[model samples]
Target chain A: MTIEQIRKTFDSFLEEHLAFGQPEGLYEPLHYLMKQGGKRLRPLLLLLATGLYDDRFERGLHAALAVELFHNFTLAHDDIMDEAATRRGKPTIYKKYGLPSGILTGDLALIYAYEQLVMGLPASLAIRLMAIFNGFAVDVCRGQQLDMEFEMREHIRMEEYLQMIAWKTAVLPAGALQIGALIGGASEEEAAILHRFGLQLGLAFQLQDDWLDTFGDEQKTGKRKGGDILQQKKTALVVYVLEHGSPEQARHLLEALKSDELQDAEKIAAVQGFLEVSGAKAAIDELQRKYTREALAQLASLNLPEARLQPLKMLAEELMGRKG
Target chain B: MTIEQIRKTFDSFLEEHLAFGQPEGLYEPLHYLMKQGGKRLRPLLLLLATGLYDDRFERGLHAALAVELFHNFTLAHDDIMDEAATRRGKPTIYKKYGLPSGILTGDLALIYAYEQLVMGLPASLAIRLMAIFNGFAVDVCRGQQLDMEFEMREHIRMEEYLQMIAWKTAVLPAGALQIGALIGGASEEEAAILHRFGLQLGLAFQLQDDWLDTFGDEQKTGKRKGGDILQQKKTALVVYVLEHGSPEQARHLLEALKSDELQDAEKIAAVQGFLEVSGAKAAIDELQRKYTREALAQLASLNLPEARLQPLKMLAEELMGRKG
Candidate 1:
């Protein structure tokens, strides 16, 4: 049940088994993007949850892989849409392989995710998994579409951003956890509780991500410092400052957001200064802690033996405080 | 059995039962792309094949829609890869929504195609459908990857081109007809026969498309005359010409392909001239006729009443010869 043990197992599964076919130029970009490491957190969570109940974790490996592959698929396609040139300090799949290959590879990943999900489940369970898997995919698309719409808008409400991320980033993990529980022979109540636990964890995870983009150690995060600030992203921190700042302070923040000529350091300092005075950082910290606490509480409410749930609780705490 | 009736049934089924949440931007690009006009030949084939048994073709509407939607999904992504600005005289989905939304919409379409298949079949049949659907999707991706490889090669072999096209464009329709037959309660042997029927028709359909690109009247075909020649596509005609043309003609063809300096009209005429003189036109025409006759013959060989399959036979004849 140790987090390290769970991650080791997941990585071995990916490395040994995920050898998809190449379609010349089309596959290289997607392959390149996926090979660039993420934390492998989503799939790890599913494995941990499944292992929580049954010792038979390997049976659910394809389900976990399905989530990871789908996550990478979204990343590849989103990079193309956002015109992002690099991911994790290297060229993005689209940049490396061009738009068509990026699109096709992303597509292959998605279709293959479904293929993997169907490999191990019983017929009735497979239908349920199909519904869950397909629903996650459709919601991710909906969220990306909304994210695009947000880009063109002059202002975005906090609720809208939360809803968007819930659809885009949160639900896949939640759905995956549910599938993991189902496959592991957990009762329906246990499955629903676990699903909520993963979702809340995801929400907190995303908020922490937004916070790290501004204040994180560049060595750990491996992104250009203040990158989101330079882009004038309508993130949670910005939304909080805009809604709560004094009238004059709000005007300064708005002017800074709209000004294209501000230097990178100056922009970051200006926005950070405004957010500090507005107490936006404190508000976000409080909100993040609330969600994290709620997620842990949900985990504790599961009637499963505490020893079985020990690894998940430790993993959740680490995720909340993670620097990268 | 009428095409108009089949279209109506498919449209009604899609509108009434897709179970898709009305997300704001999710379906916009797909709606835009699907509404643009083309002959819905793939779906029509499924409906016609179903009619070969009984008027229970209505039960197969969602399955047929899956085929068409999957086709358009590939088209949308392919347009992005090919950098095609226009499709059917309108801007393609990528050009309209940009790569991110285009990619997301295409992914959504592919998943929804699976959903439609699941919904249209019984649980027992749904499991079988997923098995077939997964294999078809993987093959399509591999074909697309190989096609990108073809674009970069100076002299792609004819066998490779056929393999690529069979995987890329032909297999889905081939699978779709068989799925239709299965949905309508045809035996495994009967389904296999219809599958061969569809595959042959698909091959002839693609070959005829290649022929029409150069030889059809510009006024009748919406596409610009000699469009494939201008693009230097390694089509069947070009392959034949490259293999059989005299040394001087081959050199001219190579020069046209390598040099961007040749004016569009001049390049088109040069390629056309080489095709004619080398008898590549006659050779390809004979090949197209061979497949067409074989496809119709396969249709006749199906152990069904003649009246039941007459509509499909007529549709194939029109498809092979029609300019638009």
Candidate 2:
């Protein structure tokens, strides 16, 4: 089946699996959030990765469901922790259901996700999949902690910023790819390579997101430019300028951040100016390119039939080729 | 090994295994909660259940850690949801570190728990244990939801109250015993029987706790009497009285609860009087006795060597022998 068909089928699978549970109060919010879909990036990535080794990619549907459910569980809890108002352009679970349901929904979603990890898989594969997923799960928490810490911290190094993004945004898709590949009967070595490919791909995607949040058109990216500036989020660009820029540049950036006289647009402009002049933008641009190049190299090294690899290749270009 | 020895070793095992993780902020509160140490009853019960069929009960230590960690995970989050100030005579995680840590700690503890379930076990058993645990974890969430519902709810049926308590308090120890028995190579039937034993035992224990909170001496129970009453918690005793009492008795109970004139001690006296006269107290007592008897019968049916079963028998006697 085509990717589009698979996605439709996945929606059916997700609803059929998690839509019903007793105590409607505890479950309706979870189903509500699941229905309010994102890109379904993690599960689709897993399914695509599994297709690399096996033609019957549908067999990995359970693993795909597990990844998606687990990802959504994090989102529900993270929304609560972040006090986020909307997800997928709609009210978050915590906002709609109140705090207790918010917490309970996330908890229950996570428990259900664990069952999916080994739900129908054989014993040895289930254990290995669990080991991989557990490590990834803990790392995600560490990343989240660091991100929250960065918000409260006075200063952050570039490496620390990267670490936070790697954990928060990068490893999830990477993990999905690795688990899917493993489930598709890929060798550990092959799956490891696919994981590296996913890491580079994910890193490039996150960097592009950071770039788009700053430099891309509001009309195109669909987000107002320089939201990170307004929130004082220490994105990779912000950290690079702070950690590596000259004192004047550093002072200018901080002043742009703290000064009341400048309007939000002016403040964003000032930060953008610093990014351009300090060459952090160019460096980050080059870094994204490097990541994309590395990701492509890994995918190419797999030596799979081109017909089999075409979808992932096309995905790489589609994700990276967007203008920023 | 003696049960006491197993408990000590379990503590050491828990520390050595879970004491290490990066991002100290995320791991510290988890370590802190695990350190504060409740009775460690679940793990000990699991180890003893394992011993019922196998002498190498220590091999079940990882499963013991998993159950204990999962239990603590619940307690940490529950404290947040309950807005509890203290647990085990100390400030709770949320109380000490704040809300984010409270939620994140529970999340991390649970993820770490999934790891422990299969950390050393063979694949098939590991999968079975996970399947069992996932159900228990979800039920606990359902139970907690019901509890919150019961709080706001004006009228609760007897069956719903029993369902809430069974989910919230009873299934945890039951799941532990069943898992340990499985690891010890008990047949599904034997493990199922052990689970039933634990269910009845846990229910009886919770009922006794309710009874002790209301009727046991302050010196013996060590809690402020009528805290549940003051909070209007729907414990078995309260639910029974509401469900089975005469209309006058029910109205009198509500009046005592709502009246501003009565002092705290007077409210306690009034409720205790209602419990004594309404036959609810006697009924709950009989129910507790029946559960204990059933639990004992399940244990006796195992027909193990007396020496092997003696410790669990002693535990049953000690727990059930408490005065209220």
True contacts kept of each: 0.73, 0.87
Give lDDT tens digits, candidate 2, residues A1-324: 677876887788887787577788888888886777887888888888888888878878888988898898898889988989987679999899988888888888788777887867788988888888887888899999998888887578888887888898888888899999998999999899888998899889888888888888777777778888887777878888888987777777877887789899888898888888889888888888999999999998996988898887887888887653
Off by over 4 Å in 2: none
As a whole number from 0 to 100, the lDDT of residue B182 in candidate 2 is 94
Interface RMSD of each: 1.9, 0.8
Clashing pairs in 2: none
TM-score, every prediction: 0.93, 0.98
Q: After superposition, how far is residue A118 of candidate 1 from its true place, in Å?
A: 0.9
State chain A's TM-score for model 2: 0.96
The residue-by-residue lDDT of candidate 2 on B1-324, one tens digit each, is 776898899988887887576777887788898999877999999999998888899879988999998998899899988999998789999999988899999998898888888878878888889989998999899899988888887667788887888899899999999999999889999999999999999999988888888887788666777888787677788788778877776677777777788888888888888888888788888989999999999988886888888998887888888873
The collision pairs in model 1 are none
Clashes of each: 0, 0
What RMSD, rounded to one decimal, does every model reach? 2.5, 1.4
lDDT of each: 0.79, 0.85
